[model samples]
Target: MTTTTTFDELPSLVGTDLGYTEYVTVTQDRVNLFAEAANDGQWIHTDPERAASGPFGGAIAHGFLTLSLTIPFWTELLEVEGVTAKVNYGLDKVRFINPVRVGSRIRMTATIASVEEVKGGLQINVDQTVEIEGQERPALISRGIHRFYA
Candidate 1:
């Protein structure tokens, strides 16, 4: 479920854990499209036959492809009631901890680490962890910054 809040309520949400999103399966089609778009057609991410003998044992999604999921995953976790615009300011830090093989399921758990008032808007720093189902380590860990305009 999503945590609903207004622009005025942001300041009170520091340290609040917003919980996890529903699991999403990563597919070979998604990885192939990402490879084409990014011009990063590495064997491990695009060529299934060759990737079967590669390090991760099969074709895997690019780390950036997994990181991009943070956008959709964030929407599933929180909703701001009074905002004219919402912008992904960017990420402060990120680490691709583990491989996300094609067909793996992933989900994210997020926390509001801090909220600060910026000119004409609120700037939020969110801590996010994207975990792979049945896996020990998360696929990605990141600190994402966002700006919400009133």
Candidate 2:
């Protein structure tokens, strides 16, 4: 995990990799729940039997479902102090590089990319990647922007 107190703290983080969280296994039940909540019930994500014969050979998690896990990953990576409000501003570039198969154990690696002063407090840019255990490629890569207000 990495902790930063000011914009200057960001520079120290360049090339530094944060630790991973305990592996969280992706399950069909969780995928189904996400699909139901997000209203994205695509066969590849919700149907196991059908997906077994489909591409990738089995049901895979939805890209957004995997993307949404970034919050939990971030929580484990850093601690924010002296902030009255913290909001997700947006994402810069996001890509689903690899499919997250059901039952796969996944964790995230976070790197502080940059930080700048904003209206309320500061805006931080973080480069985050979600990797599936034992996989050569990451399941997701994204630049996430967040705003912190005092």
> All candidates: CA RMSD in angstroms?
0.6, 1.9
The lDDT values for all models are 0.96, 0.86
The alpha-carbon lDDT assigned to residue 95 of candidate 1 equals 98
What's each prediction's clash count?
A: 0, 0
Would you estimate the TM-scores of all the predictions?
0.98, 0.91
Q: Residue by residue across 24-77, what tens digits does model 2's lDDT show? A: 999999999999999999999999999999998999999999999998888888
Best prediction by lDDT:
1
Error of 2 at 93 (Å): 1.0
Pick out the ten consecutive residues of candidate 1 with the lowest summed lDDT: 41-50
lDDT of 1 by residue, 22-72 (tens): 999999999999999999999999999999999999999999999999999
Model 2 steric clash total: 0
Off by over 4 Å in 1: none
